[model samples]
Target: MIKDRQLYKLILSILTVIVVAMIGLQLVSSWTQPQAQSQLNLYESDLLLQASTWQETNDAEPGTSPLLENLWGDSDPVQQALKNYQKIKTSATLQSGPTDDPEKRAASEAFVNELDLRLGLLYARSGQVEDAIATWTPLAEAAPSPGNQRAVTAAILQGLWSDPPQLKPQAQQQLESQLKGWFRYQSLSQLYQLQQRQETLTTLRSQEHAAAEKALTRLAAVQVFPAIGGLTGVGILIFWLIQFAVKKRQSLPEAASTAPTIEPIEAQADQTPNTPQELAATVRWPVTTIWQVMVVWFAAFFCVSFVLPVVLYVAGAKPETFGARGQAYLALIQYSLLMGVGFSILYLSLKPFLSQPLKWLPLRWQGSWFSWGLSGYLAALPLVIVISVLNQKLLQNQGGGNPLLEIILNSHDRFSMGLLLFMVAVLAPLFEEILFRGFFLTSLTRYLPMWSAIGLSGLVFAIAHLNLSDILPLTVLGCMLGFVYTRSQNLLASMLLHGLWNSGSFIGLIILGSSVS
Candidate 1:
């Protein structure tokens, strides 16, 4: 960071070019990511399926749950399921034909075919017989060899659901064995109903009833958790209206509490006041030098993010090939390396500029850090929740989200979940706060107004994620993080705030995921 102007400029220029290219690649990667709402739809469909069934012969308290009311909208669970399945049908992939890449074509067609099967069954169950017939008619008539499983399944459905048995008597016998899975289990009760086999239908319906009870119980947990969190957020909002941001008295350094004034950043290095105003209150590192450090920071960021996957790929450790636990563990290692390499380079870059430079960005454990963090957490929840709901509506779940969230949702076992929690709640907060809030926001304050610095750093933090759909919500969350650190002047406070936010997301996703699974 402290070097000859021409030499520094040359290095910075090269880094700038490389970073631009990396950013472009990241943009394409984000934009072109396959839409995975099918996963979410599948989960929600299960909950809705059970809820609709559970409401019958149970004292279901729909009127008592206003929070879940919005989730299901004005429609019954059957209608909501229908709508979810229909949305996926509309956006189903590879409607034209298989893609150029055989593997991609296979994956896309499988996904679309699954959606079609689900939508058709949902239609039949809801008594939209004509719709079901329309949807499955093509599948039943299509060339069986290409999609042998789906074709046979639809043909079987056609035979059972038609006015008279539509199957060639021998054809159903040949194909029925191929329909072996949860898919087959789900269709059994429906098939019994079609056949008017009262005894078998009654037995299968009883099994369904018991399974639906378990599902609704899980839904209750998932529903109750968010409602409680939202209410806590609302309570905090009310308290915040009466008292905003950490009070002036709480913001002052402990050393400055006895005095009305404290030293500013530009104060002379040799003149140490009895009380300090901020970290690095005496060191007068030039704003220009800080800007150089920022460049080095981003250069390392781009290199690690862009190149690490390639390195891992060449090492035969493709992330996508891993299961939940394996992927989570690999992510932990990746994050550790990122902080290790990025910080080492950052420290070396800054060492020449200011002596004991690490002191400038201290994570002091003193003062009301917990309070500040809690306030930020409370404020962040409702605000982010509102934005997220709107974000889904506006984006229609199109812009890709963090791949990590998906991993967290699917991490079923305790060891894997703990690994993810450690990475997200502990490691991520410490590393990211140091880089974004400790260094970047602190540096920006020298050139811009405090609030302006916070906002700009927040925007950068969001953009760093390389996700368009989440940018706005993450930006809002980031600004609250910056605000806490700036007001409290303690890195630990921001870390706490960050950890809580991510932990909350992890918990909520896991709850939804576990229930759905």
Candidate 2:
């Protein structure tokens, strides 16, 4: 028994060392990598700032912007800006367009327009009047809305009428004719209208900044309040533990004196069991045996869930087909198969070890199970919200979110939506609860303390999702599920709670996606 205990300790120590080493390696790797901005898509403001910096530097130094010097040594700022503009334009064309969401397309268009305007200004500053006119003319023609057209026109006129007269007489005449053709009736009135439009845009931008600041302030409050609440709870727990320990020390003498002494024969009979059944009841089974079940479970999980998906991916089963809907459907099918195969393997492997597998798993429905599940669902809702908010904040701090989840969420078609709903709200709850709580947690309880089993299972469940950003929140959710299963001894309870949590997330995502669009 001592040897077995020592072996377990050694294994644990080895695992701890391995985990620490991996974390250290990851930190080192991350430290060595160059840091970049978190936002996947650059905003118009970012480009505008860059453009303004270039303009300021060029204006101060005649022909030498630091940006141009750094990017293209000794090259003209106008040519460097044009090259940058072309690169941005090409990237924007490839990455975004009519097929993208409305918000994304709008942002892309705004960036492109800003880039064009900047390029036009750079050309005008360099005395390339023809190039400046050529740059702005297409933008004016391509502007979808009257407001956008007016903005473009205003930029064009601003460039044309700027100090030192950038335009040659012939090009100025051509541009004026084009402007007349565009406005049709009164050029002066149209120019005034354009100026007013620009003012309105500036006002709108100011309002947007104000709204963004308000939203950020609210988000900060949300993050702060939860942390404060958590700290208060911890403080209360620590206080209670200290008081309990003090009280226990004070009562130790009384407890010793009051404790009854047992007779030798009575003690021997109590300690020694007469039958195998009695001995089995007295002796606690070691939790290490549960590893057998885990080995089988993981083997099945890896083969079906990991290996199969990789094979399919290699075999030209692209996720982005059918407007990225195919990938969601594929994931649904993959998870469904994984659950089916994994459970079947687990059942086969565990069947020989237990006479009543279902009873052992405690899968039977119990009284008040609905109430337990409903309560769990209700409790989990706010936790999910809090954790989601924190997760987003963490992602912002880390400069990215879960890439896999991002891909799934980015799919907007009906098929993808339906498939994602099934994957999250139905299959995920059913299969995940079955594997994590029904099988793994139940197996773990045979050897470990109940809380230890719950925690280990929750940790495994969180890790199974393969998203570091989601680990904390998912672990919390998994522990909640474990608690529900442990209390009710009915898998349905946890499944119900899981489904409710997932459905809420699905609804929230739908709302968020719609709002963004």
Highest TM-score model number: 1
Assess the local accuracy of residue 257 in candidate 2 as a C-alpha lDDT between 0 and 100: 16
- My TM-score estimates for the predictions, one after another, are 0.82, 0.50
Tens-digit lDDT track of model 2 for 364-391: 5546668767676665555655776686
Model 2 score (lDDT): 0.53
Candidate models: Cα lDDT each: 0.68, 0.53
- Candidate 1 lDDT over residue span 1-517, tens digit each: 4568778778777876777677667766665553344466567566657655544534556476564455456887766777887876666552425458888677766667666766777777778877877887887777667447777777777666677656444443443364322234356655656557789767756765666667666666656656777678788767766555546333322322222133344443333222334433443445655656666666777767768789988998877788888888878877888888767865776677556656657566678889989888887888887887787677666667677867866667789899989988999998889888877776665445566667888988887887776677889899989877867767888999999988877776786677543
**Per-prediction backbone clash count:** 0, 1
Name the TM-score of candidate 1: 0.82
